[model samples]
Target: MARYNHPEWHPLFAGYASGPTPLTTGSYGQLLYVTEFDGAPKIISEYFPEILEPAPPMLWSHAQGAEINGIGNPNEVRALTAPTFGEHLDDWNEIKISSS
Candidate 1:
């Protein structure tokens, strides 16, 4: 009942005209009986054919002090403005630095 945009639709529809069939009674009986039997060795062999391998160790930096060589080091870096405290004034003339 679906609409198709191309002329190739007729051949595609004829290919799948015969619908799917249900599983056989013997297949269902085998599926049920297989569970009751000791099939762990066959199941394990089929599921996992190869053994797992271990991962490689990671390399880490253990350098203590700054050593700048094109690539910037964090410890060697200095502040743009060094912090200083302003003098506390008790009187107007106490301003030693001239405002002019």
Candidate 2:
């Protein structure tokens, strides 16, 4: 499973090696921090039963910005808040990423 067409979340911009489930298809709209640990990290825009409702409104991505541009995040900003990790994930947890 290797897909990366994230031109502004195009086609759900997914590159999961072995993670995202719950009918991980994607092709509607939003979906930020998607984790499959059966826990937190969820900014949905519909990822249930294959995209449904409307939970879209979580942006802020300058390719993981923060280096001279931190004024309320200015690169597709709109992410009020919903990203936390200090220990909490276990259920198919084997996070690995590479795009080079």
Clashing pairs in 2: none
CA RMSD of each candidate after superposition: 37.4, 15.8
Angstrom error at residue 63, model 1: 68
- Top candidate on lDDT is 2
Off by over 4 Å in 1: 7-21, 24-100
- lDDT per residue (tens digit) for residues 25-96 in model 1: 111111000011242311100111011221111111223222212211111212222212121112111211
Q: What is the lDDT for 49 in model 1?
A: 9
Give candidate 2's error at residue 33 in angstroms.
12
lDDT of 2 at 26: 26
Least accurate stretch of 10 residues (summed lDDT) in model 1?
26-35
Best candidate, TM-score-wise? 2
What is the lDDT for 77 in model 2? 22
